[model samples]
Target: MTSSDLCATLDESDALRLLRGGQFQLEGRLVDASNTTLRARLTLDGVTARCVYKPVRGERPLWDFPDGTLAGREVSAYLVSQATGWGLVPPTVLRDGPLGPGACQLWIDEPDDAEALVGFVPSDQLPPRWFPVAGARDEDGTAYALAHADDPRLAALAVLDAVINNADRKGGHVLRGPDDRVYGVDHGVSFHVEEKLRTVLWGWAGRPLPAEAVEVLRRLAGAVAGPLGAELAEHLTTAEIAELAGRVDRLVEQGRFPLPPQDWPAMPWPPI
Candidate 1:
Protein backbone atom coordinates (compact mmCIF):
# COMPACT_ATOMS: atom_id res chain seq x y z
CA MET A 1 0.00 0.00 0.00
CA THR A 2 1.04 3.58 -0.52
CA SER A 3 2.19 5.68 2.44
CA SER A 4 -1.07 7.64 2.45
CA ASP A 5 -3.12 4.45 2.41
CA LEU A 6 -1.12 3.02 5.29
CA CYS A 7 -1.51 6.18 7.36
CA ALA A 8 -5.26 6.28 6.76
CA THR A 9 -5.77 2.62 7.64
CA LEU A 10 -3.54 1.97 10.62
CA ASP A 11 -4.80 2.60 14.14
CA GLU A 12 -2.47 3.32 17.03
CA SER A 13 -1.95 -0.34 17.91
CA ASP A 14 -1.20 -1.34 14.33
CA ALA A 15 1.29 1.49 13.93
CA LEU A 16 3.08 0.45 17.13
CA ARG A 17 3.21 -3.20 16.00
CA LEU A 18 4.59 -2.32 12.58
CA LEU A 19 7.21 -0.02 14.06
CA ARG A 20 8.34 -2.51 16.69
CA GLY A 21 8.37 -5.60 14.44
CA GLY A 22 8.74 -4.50 10.83
CA GLN A 23 11.91 -4.80 8.76
CA PHE A 24 13.60 -1.52 7.96
CA GLN A 25 15.21 -0.78 4.60
CA LEU A 26 17.05 2.53 4.77
CA GLU A 27 16.24 4.73 1.81
CA GLY A 28 18.18 7.89 2.77
CA ARG A 29 19.34 10.13 5.60
CA LEU A 30 18.33 13.59 6.74
CA VAL A 31 21.70 15.32 6.38
CA ASP A 32 20.55 18.51 8.10
CA ALA A 33 19.73 16.70 11.31
CA SER A 34 22.18 17.02 14.21
CA ASN A 35 22.15 13.21 14.68
CA THR A 36 21.64 10.31 12.33
CA THR A 37 18.03 10.27 11.10
CA LEU A 38 17.26 7.69 8.45
CA ARG A 39 14.30 7.53 6.13
CA ALA A 40 13.16 3.97 5.51
CA ARG A 41 10.27 1.75 4.56
CA LEU A 42 8.96 -0.65 7.17
CA THR A 43 7.02 -3.78 6.24
CA LEU A 44 5.32 -6.44 8.32
CA ASP A 45 2.25 -8.64 8.06
CA GLY A 46 1.61 -7.49 4.49
CA VAL A 47 1.57 -3.84 5.55
CA THR A 48 4.06 -1.17 4.49
CA ALA A 49 4.74 2.36 5.77
CA ARG A 50 7.40 5.02 5.59
CA CYS A 51 9.23 5.77 8.84
CA VAL A 52 12.13 7.75 10.26
CA TYR A 53 14.64 5.66 12.17
CA LYS A 54 17.19 7.11 14.56
CA PRO A 55 19.68 4.52 15.72
CA VAL A 56 21.14 4.77 19.20
CA ARG A 57 24.60 4.02 17.87
CA GLY A 58 24.38 7.05 15.58
CA GLU A 59 23.42 9.58 18.26
CA ARG A 60 25.51 12.73 18.74
CA PRO A 61 26.18 13.45 22.37
CA LEU A 62 25.12 16.81 23.84
CA TRP A 63 26.76 18.25 26.90
CA ASP A 64 23.40 18.72 28.67
CA PHE A 65 21.83 15.37 27.87
CA PRO A 66 23.34 12.00 28.64
CA ASP A 67 25.02 10.28 25.72
CA GLY A 68 23.02 7.70 23.75
CA THR A 69 19.71 8.39 25.47
CA LEU A 70 18.08 10.55 22.79
CA ALA A 71 16.08 7.68 21.29
CA GLY A 72 14.52 6.74 24.62
CA ARG A 73 13.59 10.38 25.22
CA GLU A 74 11.80 10.44 21.86
CA VAL A 75 9.74 7.45 22.91
CA SER A 76 9.01 9.04 26.27
CA ALA A 77 7.67 12.17 24.56
CA TYR A 78 5.27 10.07 22.53
CA LEU A 79 4.07 8.33 25.67
CA VAL A 80 3.30 11.69 27.29
CA SER A 81 1.43 12.90 24.22
CA GLN A 82 -0.65 9.75 24.19
CA ALA A 83 -1.45 10.03 27.88
CA THR A 84 -2.76 13.57 27.35
CA GLY A 85 -5.34 12.16 24.88
CA TRP A 86 -4.42 14.86 22.37
CA GLY A 87 -2.21 12.62 20.23
CA LEU A 88 0.01 15.52 19.18
CA VAL A 89 2.88 13.11 18.54
CA PRO A 90 3.06 10.43 15.90
CA PRO A 91 3.24 6.84 17.03
CA THR A 92 6.84 6.10 18.10
CA VAL A 93 8.61 3.07 19.51
CA LEU A 94 12.09 2.22 20.72
CA ARG A 95 13.21 -0.81 18.77
CA ASP A 96 16.19 -2.32 16.96
CA GLY A 97 16.70 -0.91 13.47
CA PRO A 98 19.36 -1.65 10.86
CA LEU A 99 21.96 0.32 12.77
CA GLY A 100 20.91 -0.43 16.35
CA PRO A 101 18.05 0.02 18.82
CA GLY A 102 16.53 3.51 18.55
CA ALA A 103 13.36 5.48 17.91
CA CYS A 104 11.16 4.41 14.99
CA GLN A 105 8.28 6.81 14.28
CA LEU A 106 5.55 6.80 11.69
CA TRP A 107 6.19 9.46 9.08
CA ILE A 108 3.33 11.84 8.41
CA ASP A 109 2.70 12.79 4.81
CA GLU A 110 1.52 16.33 4.12
CA PRO A 111 -1.23 16.92 1.59
CA ASP A 112 -0.34 18.80 -1.57
CA ASP A 113 -2.41 21.78 -0.51
CA ALA A 114 -1.83 21.59 3.22
CA GLU A 115 -1.61 24.98 4.89
CA ALA A 116 1.32 25.55 7.21
CA LEU A 117 0.32 26.31 10.78
CA VAL A 118 3.71 27.73 11.66
CA GLY A 119 6.19 29.80 9.66
CA PHE A 120 7.80 33.14 8.92
CA VAL A 121 5.40 35.86 7.79
CA PRO A 122 6.00 39.43 6.68
CA SER A 123 6.52 41.49 9.82
CA ASP A 124 3.63 43.87 9.19
CA GLN A 125 1.28 41.39 7.50
CA LEU A 126 0.78 38.56 10.01
CA PRO A 127 -2.24 36.41 9.18
CA PRO A 128 -5.45 36.82 11.08
CA ARG A 129 -5.63 34.76 14.25
CA TRP A 130 -1.87 34.19 14.10
CA PHE A 131 0.53 35.35 16.80
CA PRO A 132 4.03 36.56 16.21
CA VAL A 133 6.58 35.13 18.63
CA ALA A 134 9.68 36.93 17.42
CA GLY A 135 11.04 39.27 14.75
CA ALA A 136 13.75 38.77 12.17
CA ARG A 137 15.24 40.17 8.98
CA ASP A 138 16.29 38.68 5.65
CA GLU A 139 19.86 39.16 4.34
CA ASP A 140 18.69 42.21 2.38
CA GLY A 141 16.98 43.62 5.53
CA THR A 142 13.38 42.63 4.73
CA ALA A 143 11.57 42.10 8.05
CA TYR A 144 9.76 38.85 8.98
CA ALA A 145 8.22 37.37 12.08
CA LEU A 146 8.25 33.88 13.48
CA ALA A 147 4.64 33.00 14.12
CA HIS A 148 1.99 30.28 14.37
CA ALA A 149 -1.78 30.04 14.04
CA ASP A 150 -4.12 30.56 16.98
CA ASP A 151 -5.00 26.94 16.55
CA PRO A 152 -6.20 24.72 19.38
CA ARG A 153 -4.32 21.73 17.96
CA LEU A 154 -1.12 23.75 18.06
CA ALA A 155 -1.99 24.91 21.55
CA ALA A 156 -2.29 21.34 22.79
CA LEU A 157 1.10 20.65 21.24
CA ALA A 158 2.50 23.65 23.07
CA VAL A 159 1.23 22.10 26.29
CA LEU A 160 2.83 18.81 25.36
CA ASP A 161 6.11 20.63 24.77
CA ALA A 162 5.84 22.13 28.20
CA VAL A 163 5.21 18.74 29.76
CA ILE A 164 8.11 17.16 27.92
CA ASN A 165 10.41 20.15 28.41
CA ASN A 166 11.07 20.01 24.66
CA ALA A 167 14.33 21.88 24.08
CA ASP A 168 14.00 22.14 20.32
CA ARG A 169 10.57 22.81 18.80
CA LYS A 170 11.67 24.45 15.61
CA GLY A 171 8.96 25.28 13.05
CA GLY A 172 10.05 22.41 10.82
CA HIS A 173 9.23 19.90 13.52
CA VAL A 174 5.52 20.78 13.51
CA LEU A 175 3.59 19.03 10.75
CA ARG A 176 0.09 19.20 9.33
CA GLY A 177 -0.67 15.58 8.58
CA PRO A 178 -2.79 14.43 5.63
CA ASP A 179 -4.82 12.57 8.22
CA ASP A 180 -6.03 16.06 9.28
CA ARG A 181 -4.13 15.95 12.55
CA VAL A 182 -1.46 18.27 13.90
CA TYR A 183 1.63 16.25 14.77
CA GLY A 184 4.94 17.10 16.39
CA VAL A 185 8.17 15.20 15.61
CA ASP A 186 11.92 15.35 16.33
CA HIS A 187 11.54 15.10 20.08
CA GLY A 188 14.91 13.56 20.94
CA VAL A 189 15.90 16.63 22.93
CA SER A 190 12.83 16.58 25.17
CA PHE A 191 12.15 15.43 28.72
CA HIS A 192 15.19 17.01 30.31
CA VAL A 193 14.90 17.46 34.08
CA GLU A 194 15.64 21.16 33.57
CA GLU A 195 13.18 23.74 32.26
CA LYS A 196 14.06 24.05 28.56
CA LEU A 197 10.76 24.75 26.76
CA ARG A 198 11.48 26.30 23.37
CA THR A 199 9.05 26.60 20.45
CA VAL A 200 7.43 28.90 17.88
CA LEU A 201 4.01 27.95 19.26
CA TRP A 202 4.18 30.56 21.97
CA GLY A 203 1.00 32.09 20.55
CA TRP A 204 -0.83 31.47 23.78
CA ALA A 205 1.86 32.49 26.19
CA GLY A 206 0.48 33.57 29.58
CA ARG A 207 -3.11 33.06 28.49
CA PRO A 208 -5.63 31.00 30.43
CA LEU A 209 -5.44 27.31 29.57
CA PRO A 210 -8.25 26.31 27.29
CA ALA A 211 -10.98 24.39 29.10
CA GLU A 212 -10.24 21.36 26.94
CA ALA A 213 -6.58 21.38 27.94
CA VAL A 214 -7.45 21.67 31.61
CA GLU A 215 -9.75 18.65 31.39
CA VAL A 216 -7.11 16.63 29.59
CA LEU A 217 -4.54 17.56 32.21
CA ARG A 218 -6.87 16.29 34.93
CA ARG A 219 -7.07 12.91 33.24
CA LEU A 220 -3.33 12.97 32.59
CA ALA A 221 -2.57 13.61 36.24
CA GLY A 222 -4.27 10.34 37.18
CA ALA A 223 -2.50 8.43 34.43
CA VAL A 224 0.89 9.84 35.39
CA ALA A 225 0.28 8.75 38.95
CA GLY A 226 -0.61 5.23 37.85
CA PRO A 227 0.03 3.07 34.77
CA LEU A 228 1.36 5.80 32.51
CA GLY A 229 4.16 6.62 34.92
CA ALA A 230 5.13 2.93 35.05
CA GLU A 231 5.32 2.72 31.26
CA LEU A 232 7.43 5.90 31.07
CA ALA A 233 9.92 4.46 33.54
CA GLU A 234 10.99 2.08 30.76
CA HIS A 235 12.23 5.01 28.65
CA LEU A 236 12.98 7.82 31.12
CA THR A 237 15.10 8.14 34.23
CA THR A 238 13.30 8.22 37.61
CA ALA A 239 14.15 11.88 38.13
CA GLU A 240 12.98 12.84 34.66
CA ILE A 241 9.68 11.04 35.12
CA ALA A 242 9.13 12.74 38.44
CA GLU A 243 9.82 16.10 36.82
CA LEU A 244 7.26 15.34 34.15
CA ALA A 245 4.68 14.75 36.84
CA GLY A 246 5.66 17.96 38.54
CA ARG A 247 5.29 19.95 35.32
CA VAL A 248 1.81 18.57 34.83
CA ASP A 249 0.80 19.47 38.38
CA ARG A 250 2.13 23.00 38.05
CA LEU A 251 0.29 23.58 34.78
CA VAL A 252 -2.96 22.34 36.27
CA GLU A 253 -2.56 24.53 39.27
CA GLN A 254 -1.49 27.64 37.43
CA GLY A 255 -4.16 27.31 34.71
CA ARG A 256 -2.17 29.34 32.22
CA PHE A 257 0.34 28.88 29.45
CA PRO A 258 3.95 29.38 30.53
CA LEU A 259 6.06 32.33 29.55
CA PRO A 260 9.35 31.82 27.75
CA PRO A 261 12.35 31.10 29.97
CA GLN A 262 14.54 34.13 30.63
CA ASP A 263 17.70 32.20 31.48
CA TRP A 264 17.55 30.00 28.38
CA PRO A 265 17.14 31.01 24.77
CA ALA A 266 13.37 31.32 24.32
CA MET A 267 13.47 29.75 20.88
CA PRO A 268 15.56 27.24 18.97
CA TRP A 269 18.35 28.36 16.68
CA PRO A 270 17.25 28.86 13.05
CA PRO A 271 13.71 29.11 14.42
CA ILE A 272 12.38 27.70 11.17
Candidate 2:
Protein backbone atom coordinates (compact mmCIF):
# COMPACT_ATOMS: atom_id res chain seq x y z
CA MET A 1 0.00 0.00 0.00
CA THR A 2 1.04 3.58 -0.58
CA SER A 3 2.03 5.66 2.43
CA SER A 4 -1.14 7.72 2.17
CA ASP A 5 -3.31 4.63 2.04
CA LEU A 6 -1.61 3.23 5.10
CA CYS A 7 -2.06 6.50 6.97
CA ALA A 8 -5.71 6.94 5.96
CA THR A 9 -6.80 3.34 6.55
CA LEU A 10 -5.09 2.62 9.86
CA ASP A 11 -6.51 4.34 12.90
CA GLU A 12 -4.39 4.38 16.02
CA SER A 13 -7.06 2.69 18.14
CA ASP A 14 -7.67 0.05 15.49
CA ALA A 15 -4.01 -0.66 15.16
CA LEU A 16 -3.65 -0.90 18.91
CA ARG A 17 -6.59 -3.26 19.21
CA LEU A 18 -5.47 -5.43 16.33
CA LEU A 19 -1.98 -5.62 17.70
CA ARG A 20 -3.30 -6.46 21.13
CA GLY A 21 -6.00 -8.98 20.12
CA GLY A 22 -5.48 -10.13 16.54
CA GLN A 23 -4.22 -13.56 15.57
CA PHE A 24 -0.77 -13.10 14.12
CA GLN A 25 0.33 -15.33 11.25
CA LEU A 26 4.07 -15.39 11.22
CA GLU A 27 5.46 -14.88 7.74
CA GLY A 28 9.13 -15.46 8.63
CA ARG A 29 11.99 -14.40 10.84
CA LEU A 30 13.62 -11.29 9.55
CA VAL A 31 17.40 -11.69 9.37
CA ASP A 32 19.24 -9.42 11.77
CA ALA A 33 22.40 -9.79 13.75
CA SER A 34 21.23 -8.59 17.15
CA ASN A 35 17.62 -9.67 17.67
CA THR A 36 14.97 -12.11 16.45
CA THR A 37 12.39 -10.03 14.56
CA LEU A 38 9.42 -11.54 12.74
CA ARG A 39 7.38 -10.29 9.83
CA ALA A 40 3.76 -11.16 10.41
CA ARG A 41 0.22 -10.46 9.31
CA LEU A 42 -2.29 -9.64 12.05
CA THR A 43 -5.95 -10.23 11.34
CA LEU A 44 -8.76 -8.80 13.44
CA ASP A 45 -12.43 -8.56 12.67
CA GLY A 46 -11.83 -9.68 9.08
CA VAL A 47 -9.27 -6.94 8.53
CA THR A 48 -5.55 -7.58 8.22
CA ALA A 49 -2.41 -5.54 8.53
CA ARG A 50 1.26 -6.31 7.91
CA CYS A 51 3.41 -5.81 10.98
CA VAL A 52 6.79 -6.54 12.53
CA TYR A 53 6.59 -8.58 15.70
CA LYS A 54 9.41 -8.81 18.24
CA PRO A 55 8.59 -11.48 20.76
CA VAL A 56 10.12 -10.96 24.19
CA ARG A 57 11.23 -14.59 24.25
CA GLY A 58 13.34 -14.04 21.16
CA GLU A 59 15.14 -10.99 22.46
CA ARG A 60 18.89 -11.24 22.71
CA PRO A 61 20.15 -10.13 26.07
CA LEU A 62 22.04 -6.86 26.04
CA TRP A 63 24.68 -5.85 28.53
CA ASP A 64 23.28 -2.41 29.28
CA PHE A 65 19.52 -2.74 28.74
CA PRO A 66 17.38 -4.82 31.06
CA ASP A 67 16.49 -8.26 29.72
CA GLY A 68 13.21 -8.53 27.79
CA THR A 69 12.62 -4.78 27.94
CA LEU A 70 13.32 -3.99 24.31
CA ALA A 71 9.70 -4.45 23.29
CA GLY A 72 8.53 -1.91 25.83
CA ARG A 73 11.16 0.51 24.63
CA GLU A 74 9.80 0.10 21.10
CA VAL A 75 6.28 1.05 22.20
CA SER A 76 7.62 3.93 24.26
CA ALA A 77 9.39 5.29 21.22
CA TYR A 78 6.11 5.21 19.30
CA LEU A 79 4.26 7.01 22.05
CA VAL A 80 6.96 9.66 22.38
CA SER A 81 7.03 10.15 18.63
CA GLN A 82 3.26 10.43 18.45
CA ALA A 83 3.25 12.80 21.40
CA THR A 84 5.70 15.03 19.57
CA GLY A 85 3.16 15.35 16.68
CA TRP A 86 5.55 14.03 14.03
CA GLY A 87 4.41 10.42 14.21
CA LEU A 88 7.99 9.57 13.37
CA VAL A 89 7.42 6.00 14.39
CA PRO A 90 4.76 3.75 12.92
CA PRO A 91 1.92 2.53 15.12
CA THR A 92 3.27 0.05 17.66
CA VAL A 93 1.99 -1.65 20.78
CA LEU A 94 2.95 -4.24 23.37
CA ARG A 95 0.86 -7.38 23.17
CA ASP A 96 0.77 -11.14 23.30
CA GLY A 97 1.55 -12.53 19.88
CA PRO A 98 2.21 -15.92 18.25
CA LEU A 99 5.56 -16.34 19.97
CA GLY A 100 4.90 -14.56 23.24
CA PRO A 101 4.36 -11.13 24.76
CA GLY A 102 6.15 -8.60 22.57
CA ALA A 103 6.00 -5.48 20.44
CA CYS A 104 3.89 -5.43 17.29
CA GLN A 105 4.61 -2.51 15.02
CA LEU A 106 2.80 -1.65 11.80
CA TRP A 107 5.07 -2.18 8.81
CA ILE A 108 5.92 0.69 6.50
CA ASP A 109 5.40 -0.06 2.80
CA GLU A 110 8.24 1.91 1.28
CA PRO A 111 8.89 1.52 -2.42
CA ASP A 112 11.62 -0.92 -3.42
CA ASP A 113 13.57 1.69 -5.33
CA ALA A 114 13.57 4.22 -2.53
CA GLU A 115 16.67 4.40 -0.32
CA ALA A 116 18.29 6.43 2.46
CA LEU A 117 20.86 8.90 1.16
CA VAL A 118 23.62 7.65 3.50
CA GLY A 119 27.22 6.99 2.56
CA PHE A 120 30.78 8.20 2.67
CA VAL A 121 31.63 11.28 0.66
CA PRO A 122 34.79 13.31 0.20
CA SER A 123 35.02 16.22 2.64
CA ASP A 124 35.76 18.68 -0.12
CA GLN A 125 33.23 17.26 -2.59
CA LEU A 126 30.13 16.99 -0.36
CA PRO A 127 26.84 17.07 -2.27
CA PRO A 128 24.63 20.12 -2.12
CA ARG A 129 22.13 20.13 0.77
CA TRP A 130 23.50 16.86 2.17
CA PHE A 131 25.58 17.43 5.33
CA PRO A 132 28.43 15.58 6.94
CA VAL A 133 27.58 13.38 9.91
CA ALA A 134 31.15 12.42 10.77
CA GLY A 135 34.62 12.20 9.27
CA ALA A 136 36.53 8.97 8.93
CA ARG A 137 39.55 7.32 7.30
CA ASP A 138 39.96 4.38 4.91
CA GLU A 139 42.66 1.68 5.00
CA ASP A 140 44.89 3.92 2.89
CA GLY A 141 44.54 6.67 5.52
CA THR A 142 42.43 8.85 3.25
CA ALA A 143 39.54 10.97 4.47
CA TYR A 144 36.10 9.30 4.50
CA ALA A 145 32.93 11.31 4.86
CA LEU A 146 29.54 10.27 6.28
CA ALA A 147 26.40 12.18 5.34
CA HIS A 148 22.55 12.14 5.32
CA ALA A 149 19.68 13.95 3.60
CA ASP A 150 18.90 17.57 4.47
CA ASP A 151 15.14 16.94 4.44
CA PRO A 152 13.13 18.41 7.29
CA ARG A 153 11.63 15.03 8.17
CA LEU A 154 15.09 13.58 8.69
CA ALA A 155 15.94 16.57 10.81
CA ALA A 156 12.83 15.94 12.85
CA LEU A 157 13.86 12.31 13.24
CA ALA A 158 17.18 13.42 14.68
CA VAL A 159 15.28 15.40 17.26
CA LEU A 160 13.10 12.39 18.03
CA ASP A 161 16.18 10.28 18.55
CA ALA A 162 17.60 12.85 20.92
CA VAL A 163 14.44 12.97 23.03
CA ILE A 164 14.24 9.18 23.20
CA ASN A 165 17.99 8.62 23.61
CA ASN A 166 17.83 6.18 20.72
CA ALA A 167 20.99 4.09 20.89
CA ASP A 168 20.75 2.63 17.43
CA ARG A 169 19.61 4.70 14.43
CA LYS A 170 21.22 2.88 11.53
CA GLY A 171 20.66 3.99 7.96
CA GLY A 172 18.32 1.07 7.26
CA HIS A 173 15.93 2.39 9.90
CA VAL A 174 15.11 5.36 7.67
CA LEU A 175 12.69 4.65 4.81
CA ARG A 176 11.44 6.57 1.79
CA GLY A 177 7.80 5.57 1.43
CA PRO A 178 5.81 5.18 -1.78
CA ASP A 179 4.09 8.48 -1.10
CA ASP A 180 7.56 10.06 -0.93
CA ARG A 181 7.59 10.64 2.84
CA VAL A 182 10.37 9.43 5.08
CA TYR A 183 9.42 6.97 7.81
CA GLY A 184 11.59 5.70 10.68
CA VAL A 185 11.35 2.15 12.09
CA ASP A 186 13.13 -0.37 14.34
CA HIS A 187 13.06 1.44 17.67
CA GLY A 188 13.72 -1.53 19.90
CA VAL A 189 16.60 0.18 21.71
CA SER A 190 15.56 3.56 22.98
CA PHE A 191 14.58 5.68 25.99
CA HIS A 192 17.45 4.55 28.15
CA VAL A 193 17.95 6.62 31.29
CA GLU A 194 21.60 7.09 30.47
CA GLU A 195 23.01 9.17 27.64
CA LYS A 196 23.13 6.80 24.67
CA LEU A 197 22.16 8.67 21.50
CA ARG A 198 24.02 6.84 18.74
CA THR A 199 22.79 7.53 15.20
CA VAL A 200 23.81 8.44 11.66
CA LEU A 201 21.62 11.56 11.48
CA TRP A 202 24.09 14.21 12.58
CA GLY A 203 23.59 16.18 9.36
CA TRP A 204 22.25 19.10 11.33
CA ALA A 205 24.41 18.64 14.41
CA GLY A 206 25.17 21.89 16.24
CA ARG A 207 22.61 23.76 14.12
CA PRO A 208 19.44 25.45 15.31
CA LEU A 209 16.34 23.28 15.29
CA PRO A 210 13.94 24.20 12.53
CA ALA A 211 11.07 26.44 13.65
CA GLU A 212 8.39 23.79 13.25
CA ALA A 213 10.54 21.23 15.01
CA VAL A 214 11.19 23.60 17.90
CA GLU A 215 7.45 24.16 18.17
CA VAL A 216 6.87 20.41 18.25
CA LEU A 217 9.49 20.06 20.96
CA ARG A 218 7.69 22.68 23.00
CA ARG A 219 4.43 20.75 22.77
CA LEU A 220 6.24 17.56 23.70
CA ALA A 221 7.79 19.25 26.69
CA GLY A 222 4.33 20.17 27.97
CA ALA A 223 2.89 16.73 27.31
CA VAL A 224 5.74 14.82 28.92
CA ALA A 225 5.13 16.46 32.26
CA GLY A 226 1.45 15.49 32.17
CA PRO A 227 -0.48 12.73 30.33
CA LEU A 228 2.50 11.62 28.27
CA GLY A 229 4.51 11.15 31.43
CA ALA A 230 1.85 8.91 32.96
CA GLU A 231 1.51 6.84 29.80
CA LEU A 232 5.23 6.29 29.39
CA ALA A 233 5.61 5.24 33.01
CA GLU A 234 3.56 2.17 32.17
CA HIS A 235 6.40 0.78 29.99
CA LEU A 236 9.55 2.44 31.34
CA THR A 237 11.18 3.00 34.67
CA THR A 238 10.24 6.12 36.62
CA ALA A 239 13.78 7.34 36.17
CA GLU A 240 13.69 6.72 32.44
CA ILE A 241 10.42 8.61 32.08
CA ALA A 242 11.82 11.54 34.03
CA GLU A 243 14.93 11.54 31.89
CA LEU A 244 12.81 11.51 28.76
CA ALA A 245 10.99 14.60 30.02
CA GLY A 246 14.27 16.26 30.87
CA ARG A 247 15.58 15.61 27.36
CA VAL A 248 12.57 17.29 25.82
CA ASP A 249 12.80 20.21 28.20
CA ARG A 250 16.45 20.71 27.46
CA LEU A 251 15.93 20.65 23.69
CA VAL A 252 13.05 23.11 23.81
CA GLU A 253 15.07 25.33 26.05
CA GLN A 254 18.20 25.18 23.91
CA GLY A 255 16.45 25.43 20.51
CA ARG A 256 19.27 23.71 18.63
CA PHE A 257 20.54 20.30 17.59
CA PRO A 258 23.08 19.14 20.15
CA LEU A 259 26.60 18.01 19.57
CA PRO A 260 27.44 14.42 20.43
CA PRO A 261 28.39 13.81 24.01
CA GLN A 262 32.18 13.62 24.47
CA ASP A 263 32.46 10.34 26.36
CA TRP A 264 29.87 8.25 24.51
CA PRO A 265 30.25 6.80 21.04
CA ALA A 266 28.71 9.47 18.83
CA MET A 267 27.58 7.02 16.14
CA PRO A 268 26.52 3.41 16.20
CA TRP A 269 28.86 0.77 14.86
CA PRO A 270 28.44 -0.14 11.17
CA PRO A 271 27.40 3.47 10.70
CA ILE A 272 25.22 2.96 7.64
Models 1 onward score TM values of 0.98, 0.91
Worst 10 residues of 2 by lDDT: 1-10
The residue-by-residue lDDT of candidate 1 on 66-178, one tens digit each, is 99999999988899899888888999999987897999999889889999999999999999999999989989999999889999899999999998999999999998887
Best by lDDT: 1
- The C-alpha stretches of model 1 lying farther than 4 A from their native spots are none
Whole-model lDDT values for every prediction? 0.91, 0.84
Candidate 1's displacement at residue 228, Å, is 0.8
Model 1 TM-score? 0.98
lDDT of 2 by residue, 181-240 (tens): 677888878988889999999878889988998888888888888898898888899999
